[model samples]
Target: MTLRAYPVRYLPGEDELVWTGGLGVTVRFTPGVEPLTMADEVDLLVVTPEDFSESLQPLVEHKDSYGVATRLVTLEDVYGGVFFEVRGRDEAERVKYFIKDAVEEWGVRYVMLVGGRNGGLLEEKWWCPVRYAHLDDGSNWEASYLSDLYFADIYNPDGSFSSWDTNGNDLFAEYSLMSKDILDLYPDVYVGRLACRNSYEVEVMVDKIITYETTAHGSEWFHRMVAVGGDSAPRAGDPWYEGEEENKAALSYMDDFEEVTLWTSDGSLSGPQDVIDAVSRGCGFLFFDGHGNPMNWATHPPHDEETWIDGLGVGDMRKLSNDGMYPVCVVGGCHNGQFNVSLLNLLKIYEGYQHWYSYIYKGEVSPESWAWWITRMAGGGAIASLGYTGLDWFATGDGDQDGIPDCTQYLSGFMHVNFFWEYGENGRRMLGELHGETVADYINAFFPTTEKLDYKTAEEWALLGDPSLMVGGYP
Candidate 1:
């Protein structure tokens, strides 16, 4: 099949150009504060009139599918070649807008561009300054509702610095000073700096240093920063899944679980309400497997809008104020667990959603690994609550027969077992561990009348598993 391409060319000294239908136009610009290195590959899409309809169909159809704005470019017959300027803005934004506009305007479909110097557009908007500061006072503050703030002092380790403004005052000035220091140390870090209105702080200095890489200029660096750390929520089965042997092995492990419900689909949760109803019916754990984006729920295209409470704002998906009792929700897809504080601000406006465990993966992930993780978790393994492994298993053909495709497999084998195990084990472990009762005592402790388990507090119940597991609560 012929693929469409978006070609972005840089022309030095020329403001614009005139192009016939067949000739390519040049875009004049430079790399922002941080130059695009060999590591940073710019994606280009080129589209012509022939494929315009085909190129735009999916985007137009899925407009609010992910809840974020998607950009499209339609290039007119430039009576004169258009000027793609990247002056004044920071490097990152400059490049981003230039490329974004190019694709949106010129009907580009395929992306191929030379890396480094004299070829691609140089833009300024991409640069943002990085700041480091030690708060004068030891109080901690929330920088922004949905944004993440990194706090650390150059000198201290344990208690050296904090990001609190005890007086409820904005800490923009203080933040700017620290940012200036970061800029001074790494001039190419960002195009410029801005003070944070909220005084959010990071407790660990090591974490602060690492966060700077994310806020830096290049896309490669930003993606790398987001991919770092053991922050990803765990999956159910073993980390490796081959053919039926692996599948049978994984399934055998799941025999200990009392109940199991497996939901499979391409990448959307078409029956979230049914699952919710089951959870409300006292199903303990809920597992979802499929393709997922960072800020929205993954469902099949032509989403069932009726399921979402109209006009309800968002914080957590569970807090949508549905009549059913919320089960422990687990998303086994890529990026579902990931949350940005900035995005949270958007959710808080809605009433029905509140804070729930949203374990996120940073990049592309496969359904097979998800399947393995789920099965293992269902069988009583402790892998589901720790670490992120983004897209590492795609090359392995771990679970699926055809290998895992990039399309969101949101509800396939990945979501089935994990949800089953989590819900089944919920209240039982609580009384046994929290009350210090023997396994026999705990077994006998179940109420004969209701067959229900009781716990004194949520925290005590939540501490049933190894305290070290990072993702979900213990119980």
Candidate 2:
């Protein structure tokens, strides 16, 4: 099939509005490129990287106005370059994966592929449909691993490279080994780890780890790795030892509230009974700190006894079980705030009333930060009443002895700004009163504002905030 490329140029010296009108009609005509002129075919519009910005503007406007799903294809390898340009490589990869999936679903072929510095030597090759075909088949193309690899040598604004090998390698090796073992047991299963730079690395690691007659081994392994059993495991212990002081302080703050209920155990409460009871008693924020699986709820061992015989696991959060005054559920766990299909489904089951924030990483969170987050909510700084706290490092508020621990405060402040600026402008202003200027300013002032912020500085800045803050409270 011959692909017709549509190029929209913002001609200089020409009337911008007129140019936009002409561009819109030109884009509208692009749907005729495919042989099968179906609704789905019309959905796919291919454009070069140069035109991506302009082309997407119209599509975004159209979608907002009419609620239509129009997929756009950019030849630019947004994911591959992301590791070089951004910090969260895993997120970058996820975005890329999502784009690929959307393109495939729209029945589109070929994207104008560009190469990044670490995109490997193969990326230097000219854009070819065969290369695109290989990626589609998952045969000859390189598989994604995680964001750590791409950001292994992040660049500084002054052209210096930030070495993240020491930290990243260790994490990657462990995750890789674990993935390999899991794939070895179940060869057909898809195994992937989320990476930095908005990407996810997925590759077939092993041949098999499970076999007949070894059912016990398989079961044990599955339970250990995948099950969300109660908080008995070593990993379930509070990872933030630095947060002892802040945690104490937060507990002190909680004393002012009526009833502070901390759901530290794993697994879903039996048939919403606990939730019902809490609601009946008019409980405050429902705080859940425990292990969680995307599809199964595994309570701590002893509590499992109370579970229903046919009760739903994590997968059943979308189904009806109990109805009453619902308290906002704050899931201090991973991937709970994905804002994707799973969360949408969860919304459906809860009659779209339950507030949920999920997908919290353990390392980037702290008791103190959690306390501050809830305190802000209780203080009426926010009205959404539910949402996941973004990634944060667990640390004591007194580690640096300024007020909040530098890392915890910075991340908390950043996420607060990001969330409020995007979703709650008023909330952002209120948070600003507590934390001062926005996270973007904080990041740019101290950290290297280059294509790639050196991972070392990134990590350091993540901990210490702007270095100027170290000298004085005012930057």
Candidate 3:
């Protein structure tokens, strides 16, 4: 299956293009200081939209006070010279070049995309870069999905471009999205997106981050983890049923916890009300493992012969008044964190080649999509989230053919390791570091073993909140 590119005139609703849609800037980047340099290795870089640049100061300062090194810069600084020059080049590619330079020159560890994405209209606004990732190597129509993993996987180990285009097509990040040789697979650097639409949304997120880190609210609640499990394999007796997400949730939450409250699809905890109530009541962290779509988290109950429950959606999440008490929700489900690209783009690229459209077209654009809505809610939602951007694969998550329960799904395992292993084992208390550690841990596990690199399944997931937000220990 080949990705067919159309000329500008051939595309429909040309005005709705999000990429290359930012306003032109006349001035190029002139740091004024001779050759830019940072005395210490850079740990975090905040790329804010020009409009919301100043408002991010407090957040950056907060990150600094924690002894975590960070720098905040506007898109203009990187793009330099008139808006048209920035427009002339693909913003995503240009941004990647900047990141590549930072990685090589400044010893940068993490990059944060500070704005949100708008699905309705693709007018000039904050940038939300998109990448084309392959699901499998074969002629799989569904193989090519929209992703932002391209930005994360910058180079190959051989010093050549892994380019996601293993076939060496001019189209870099396409089918066979990431090459195992791309050490970035372990992700040399971590990335996160704040997903804020405006300065107000930015305010809401920053407030949550600062308060969650500084205030002495219920210190007692910080250790309380609410683990919600979803559907088990359609048929219980089967060894492997859709990756055993429900089972993973229980063990993952209990992985390092002795006092945490673990909720499952059991009759009492699987209902929509139960999940919402749990989130509303607030907890140190939240976990959900089950089937998911952009619109909602749906699961089939193991009980009744054929009964299912309608799980919570982003709209339902917005309805929650968790006050200032927010939990870092780590969801092990598909499309749980599909921030920028959506089902529509998924369909457009694979439209003629696949028959999956009917089942895949469940979500629309930005404001309505699941990931951005929850993380950017006006009052309370997750301060940060670690979830999937596209369909999550379960079969090979634990090496494709391992025994049931013994095997781990790609994302499920990542979250489990992040909280259980990475937290104290690696000493990463910041969300950004935890996220990077999570992916790195997963890569370390699968790497060196000769296991085929399955970047799509894991790379599809990402951090949907502020990268610098602290994980557990508070200041």
Candidate 4:
């Protein structure tokens, strides 16, 4: 069998060059070219709908006063050709192009997207367009999942525009037999989203950010960390406490903080009330490792995958009253970050039982994902959260033949724990920086491919909070 060479062109006239066993080789280096148009440097760029701009102003001011150098631009500014030249196949692409320009022209290091479904729960309109990745893993009900990483990965290693749709089929992030786009999977700029469905939510989140950053410093609650888990996959055998092990890994990295463990092994995590009670007390960080869906996160009792333990659900968010002391939550599960879900899906489901099953694969079938609800909760809930937008995967055994269980290495379990590791060991103070660095580090450690779960692992994992967030608040 002969191997086919895949050539990538980063600049013009690259295809014209042909090297045929040259007698002598010469290398030339050129100085970097300056930008043709320079704009005011912006450290954090907040992209929101016009309706949200007013609500987000306080957040911008707070960031500026804290020396983050933030600037707010609406979706209108991007699409109307007011600031950035409108150019892309769709609105989502156009938004991505604007982010690319912001990185180069305005020197933007972080991007915060603050918008969600524009209308009521039954409406399908979006305040900020979302990009869906068409990476089918056959086992999952949905072939596509929401991916914000597309906006942050601006360019490939070759310096070419990293349009996720490299095949030009307009199907972004395809990783199936039908189509596959080789992605760089490296974040050029740190990106996060608030996914606020309305202006009220925007105001609530802005207030939360301001209060957290300004007053959270030196608070004893900020030094506490809550870690909860149960048996994630008992079928895998042996330890029978995969969830607890993952949580322990995160706690290991967070040695400075007081650790609070609620595990099935100890019967502390018997029900959702346990989670609600623990979170109400307030802590700097919350790590939940288990199985999850759009509305709830659940797990099995130790060594028993059949019996389910409803850990936490969207409905339980309201029970939290940890106001002024919010934890940055990291959830290890599936569909917890599926921000595309809307109330309109219920209408489709009401049509009939047949349509209900069919619509599940098409996506958008929930009022809100667990991560979004937690972040948008008025007085309590997590200040920020990271979770998967679709079905998550973990190695059953030593899939990589690396001696250690692959589940503990580079899929859902590893990504969830690494966020804390990056914060504690690597000293990634900014949430987005920690998130972006974690993605880059994961890709570096496990070379992702179209057929491998690694690609989807990196693509589907998303952050729901300000990318410029200061973990444990600003000092």
Candidate 5:
């Protein structure tokens, strides 16, 4: 796949957040000495780097209208720039302790990390540390993934030690080594992340949040969902695409909602203007599955019989007709959550470590991953999006042509279905709890097993927006 350049969307006054700051500070607090009081009675705490801490106040204030007692704190404010020198502990332990204290002491129910998780490589202490998981991959190699679940997994049943690195191996999120009693599959404290790389990006996001929340939107508009499923594999020889049948099956959970099925638009994924037009009409939820990346999703729109994939992308955000109404988009695609950019990742792409699953790979122009761009779109971005930071694991059969190769046996479909079921059917509202509940549901369904695929699946997927933003069910 070749890189494609598309027109970038711009929001006026977005340049105000550009700031210059480098890693040249000294560590302040010593180990076992985070002298912070957890006496503040707040429901939501927004965490950011100290540089952007001032600007975040406005965003926090705007979110305050939502009736949640929201507060803003810098990582330094929480950690005092201290690096915990414990096994399976690092700078991220600061956030862990803060959250633990908030949950234990204060009435804090939600904690939102409001900056990028990509820490600077060379530093005595990490900058905006992200929690990590050490799950063994199916390939037999140990795979470490960025996980927010760590902060939420604060204490064990005994409430003695923070069960980060069990077996004292100094590795956090090693599910195999960690004691089960410590693990909170259904985390009591809800968690979220902003995932912005810079203050400018955060500013843009803040503007969107203010505009979205301040304006009154129709509840029925949100109840109207749109499901788009693209070909999982090249339907070069056949007319109909793969993944639609099962995707439609998964979409059935939202049967009551006024929805548009793009996979079977006029009965197939090849409908000419179905999805492009569907977005123009407002909806509460958007579900898409198929070959894709952060830049673009694959679709055999209208013509193009030889599986010439032309699909939606970040560049198309400007052209979208949806203005104020933002849906919660769930993309069952690969690498839409690969928010960080690096030259080394290009090399990984060549080595198949970073698989480019779509036709239109991201070029130099687009600001963030298409997955995130959906939420931050100037016209109308969703409240939240869930996608894979890496490959969305799916089970494939051994050249079986007897029937439709049902990939729904994979966790991707189950999670996708469970998400809708949690929202549409179960009447659950908040994104993070829904995410946790879905993971817990999947685990409960497939318990008494050591399947690496299921474990790795939960580790790689993430939510890309506000977790506490409740999508109050069908009005």
Candidate 6:
């Protein structure tokens, strides 16, 4: 009676054993002996680099205290084949395979990726590597952008791995006029990220999550939802202020929360100063409907003059004094969620700006995106933020061809406003549930692959935060 571990594979003549136990065995041997398994039954799985393992323990404990049944697995653990066999073309796919295994064995509902680049603003290294989707919307000159959705959409419809590499060319989610890879955009599990470069940032986030869950319930500030916008797309023949209309639609679902409108039509959204003042005061949630880049989030006024009314920037993060009262910010704009921005790209300026050059790579801008700056703010900022990692598009006129106007659709507005709809109307309290369900709902309604813009829309939208967060705190 000895024990040994072997990679599960199909035997040439042996039939696969079918069982209803806590394991998925591909083959069985050794009569009268049960196999060992990692069947701990996890509700939330935290994946991070070994360096941040100690820093994330508090978050693990806090989640457990709230009956979440959390588990923390390091990159080293998965790569070393401690719990699952290593497989995939790259590290990103390997991590995704681990997620699939977790779902099948431990029944994980939420996953939190807890690491980012390893060095300072100038020097960088990916601790937890990300997958870049090559879904070209024809307008995206860069052709690729970081997407965490690949990790969440673990399985395809028929229980096969949703590798996002359908064409088998190793180009994941590649979509062009000539080459295309069909994908099951629906998420098998909800996922989020903490893009922390160091342990201090990890500590900051852990404390924020713990405090928010333990103390945020029934707070008056938590009852107020702040909606800020102007003219997101000031187009002729379109409405004078489309952003305000979008915000109003989002506010319609959140009827219980106090509506704090700071729109340009009301003379409230004049500049960044107004936004800073409001954020400093704090609120339960913040919806910023406008145009944005990695450096800043801004929009035009009520008319179609195209005058930019600045809302927030990475530099203004220090002015936030709301402290523990962080809102889950949903910014509707382009590149606000582009977490792949690197300061090291500044050195490449010697190469003249070409087709691949994105404006976000400017040397003067912050290395991190606006939404990340908000989430990583030491004391006052957002607990989480959802936005597009690339060029976000709104429906010009019934892009879906559903007969009804496109503005009435879900992703056409703030896009993530469906997150609010999930929470307010559907009663999805967990942050990731709202986030994942929003994506799933979009996929269900749009049947994505039909339009390139639709496919890019779902792929680029990303959530940056803990996925298992209890919305409005644990009451």
Show how many residue pairs clash in every candidate, following the order shown: 95, 47, 16, 0, 2, 0
Candidate 3 wrongly placed segments (more than 4 Å): 1-41, 81-89, 119-126, 136-141, 158-170, 176-184, 216-218, 239-265, 303-305, 341-361, 396-419, 447-453
Scored by lDDT, model 2 comes in at: 0.25
Name the runs in model 2 displaced over 4 angstroms: 1-71, 74-313, 320-392, 403-418, 421-442, 445-475
Residue 287 of model 6: what lDDT?
Answer: 91
Residues 1-475 of candidate 2: C-alpha lDDT, one tens digit per residue: 2222223221111212111233332222344344332124423232224332352344334432333333443445443443223223443333334333434345322221211112212122212111110001122212221121122112222223332222443232122222310001100101111101111100000000011111222221111100111232222323332222222222333322443332323234443344334333433223333322233222333323343222123323323221221222333222222111122232333333332232122221111222112211221211112222222222122333444433223332233323223222333212112122233333433232221111111221111010011010111
Give per-residue lDDT, candidate 4, residue 372: 89
TM-scores for candidates 1 onward, in order: 0.24, 0.28, 0.75, 0.89, 0.74, 0.87
lDDT of 4 by residue, 192-264 (tens): 9999888888899999998888888899998999998887888654553778888877888987899889898
Q: Which candidate would rank higher by lDDT, 3 or 5?
A: 5
Question: Model 6: runs farther than 4 Å from truth?
Answer: 1-40, 119-124, 353-365, 397-405, 408-410
Per-residue lDDT of candidate 1, residues 348-467 (tens digit)? 223333322221232111212222222122212112221111211111222233343211111122222322223233332221121122211222222111111111010011111111
Best by TM-score: 4
Q: For residues 404-455, what per-residue lDDT tens digits would candidate 5 score against the true structure?
A: 4435544676678778778768878777778877876766554434555666
User: What Cα-based lDDT does every candidate model obtain?
Assistant: 0.23, 0.25, 0.59, 0.82, 0.62, 0.79
Error of 5 at 160 (Å): 4.6
Ordered by TM-score, highest first, the candidates read: 4, 6, 3, 5, 2, 1
